[model samples]
Target: MVTRQRLRRRNIGILALLLAGLVCFGVVEGVALPRQDQMEAQYNAAQNSPLTHDIARTSHYATRYMGNASKVTGLFRSLPLGPIRSFALDPDVFTVQVNLDASAPMAEIDRDRAYLYSATAAFAYIDNLEAVIFNEGSVAYRVTREGLLTWYGLDGFAALTADSAVWKTEVQDKLAEQDYARRAFQELFRESKTLSV
Candidate 1:
């Protein structure tokens, strides 16, 4: 009782369904998938910009010494009182006010907070100091010290406040080392730029 006309019509319907499924799949794979990939790439790039990362890393590493009050005290302990006082008064040497990014990671924020707190506490022993906080904790004064006793306890301020010239040489030597490190960092950054490009 089977008819050729009915069989042919049934086969034509099956072919039409298969054709529609193939078209839908092609649109999804060819158009939607590429668009999705492009959006993901853009999101990733925004999350991790190379320049921002490099700046943050450099600042964190370069300023790590500011977080250790004891170390800072030790470094300047042997310095002569006159040069120490002069350095403290020098606007170009001790004037520092850094505004950290609020969006930075918690670890980075904590490090910044520690540096500010330790530096401020250590420098509070200085006489005639004008340390001010303004703009909702966004600004502060330079770090320096002159007196013998701090709020925490006695630092190495006694020897530093005494007469000495050897410490000045040591300080200058340390600065030279830091300068070398900075130059090396710059060279590495330039190399990275070349590689990236």
Candidate 2:
């Protein structure tokens, strides 16, 4: 009788432990796994965003010892805007003629973001770059290295070499927000000469 009682008790304890293990496995699979997947998706989307890509690309080039004017052309092409028709790189200023549809002009805010991001990337990569001008046929926006650095309130635009999280907070994420981008655009380009090309 005693032996039978002991065996029954041992079996019950083993069954309880197995049930507990199953519960833990269910929680991890049903709840934790989905949460982790959702977070991963959001991160991937942010990293793949156009703005993020531009920032990351510029950051990558900045790590190089020297950068050329071709990098600037590459930067403009990477923007969401239409293709570049032609570009003339002076000793200090780089002018880009972009092909845009007259019927469907880019939005003002979008133009600002594109120009600002491009200038930011240019100044970051090209060490001797002074200014960048984007000509949309009708008008042109000139962004100077001095003006952009001043607007960003940084003595040197070391944002390119900053840690990923810091760069995102200071540049990438801010440019993604319309209000912040507009404010930066106005601050950097307000005094710029917008001449008819």
Compared with the true structure, all predictions reach lDDT values of 0.34, 0.64
Let me know the TM-score candidate 1 reaches against the reference structure. 0.27
TM-score, per-candidate, Cα-based = 0.27, 0.60
Least accurate 10 contiguous residues by lDDT in model 1: 188-197
lDDT of 1 by residue, 73-187 (tens): 3333321111122122223233222332334323422233333333333343333333311111233223234221342245543243232342223221222344433442232
Candidate 1 wrongly placed segments (more than 4 Å): 50-197
Candidate RMSDs in Å, in order, are 20.5, 6.9
Candidate number with greatest lDDT: 2
